[model samples]
Target: MPAPRKYPDELPERAVREVRTTSRPIAHVAKDLGIHKEALRGWVRQAEADAGERDDRLTAAEHEELKQLREEAAELRRANEILKAASAPFAQELDRPRTRPTRRSTA
Candidate 1:
């Protein structure tokens, strides 16, 4: 369900390494690779996360799990709402006793 990536993972890996090993600016590196500077910056951040250099972002698996959890939570909330709606009219009758209907005279 994920969108197609504009650039391949290998390309970013190579680009990040190029930026780190070379003294070139990130914009310069991204320009050389024909990628957007912001995209390249995201790749660098991701690389750092993968390397455990950054602690704020989640790892790929953790991020995936979180996405799945959020989706499941949304679905459960929807189901709860549906159940509530279906039982709305009946809920008020819980304490009432059943009664027989009065017969009507036929003409």
Candidate 2:
């Protein structure tokens, strides 16, 4: 299982909002808050994305959906592989012609 979120969604939003309102450099605020500068940078980017600032990153819901779709695709592929493996011997048997049994002679 993955670790629980270190920072909740609202916290990041609040942090970004504070930085935006105060016009303070992220590094300084992040230092004050004891958070990594890069983590704050990511929060800012996510905030921008939510506000339609960047097109490069997916929104949280879109990101979750993409992850689920990828997992479903991988599961379907595994099922197909398993079906192929399970049917291989049966397929080989089907390919052979059936022979009639010989009749025994009665004296």
Candidate 3:
């Protein structure tokens, strides 16, 4: 006859609280809890992935905004350069000495 299948044991209350509070490795706690390492690892990984994805989405949005801002700054710089190039000749003309015409005296 086949041996009766053993059910998994419930984890200790204190250990459960510790796992919740400290964010320690579930595999380590699982050892004390007398559960399979793979099962605990699966739960931990799923929870971690879910939490990480939430923060990742926010980071991605910030990155896209930064990229757009950088492009706008670069475009403004290019416009400023063009304006400077266009104004250089006028600036030089203003800097040159002005010649005055002598007035002729009428008798």
Q: Name the best candidate (by lDDT).
A: 1
Per-residue lDDT, model 3, residue 76, is 100
lDDT by residue (5-105, candidate 3, tens digit) is 35333443355556768878877887877777676664454444445744423343465799889999999999999999999999999999999999999
**lDDT (Cα, 0-100) at 106 in candidate 2:** 100
Model 1 over residues 1-107: C-alpha lDDT tens digits?
A: 77998888699889999988996999999998999999999888887887899999887778889999999999999999999999988987886888999999898
State candidate 2's TM-score.
Answer: 0.79
Best to worst by TM-score, what's the order?
A: 2, 1, 3
* Candidate 3 or 2, higher TM-score: 2
Off by over 4 Å in 1: 1-4, 95-107
Sort the predicted structures by lDDT, highest score first.
1, 2, 3
The local distance difference test score of each candidate is 0.90, 0.88, 0.67
Q: What is the TM-score of each predicted model, taking all chains together?
A: 0.74, 0.79, 0.44
Candidate 3 lDDT for residue 21: 81
Model 2 misplaced stretches (Cα beyond 4 Å): 8-10, 98-107
The candidate 2 region of ten consecutive residues with least summed lDDT is 6-15
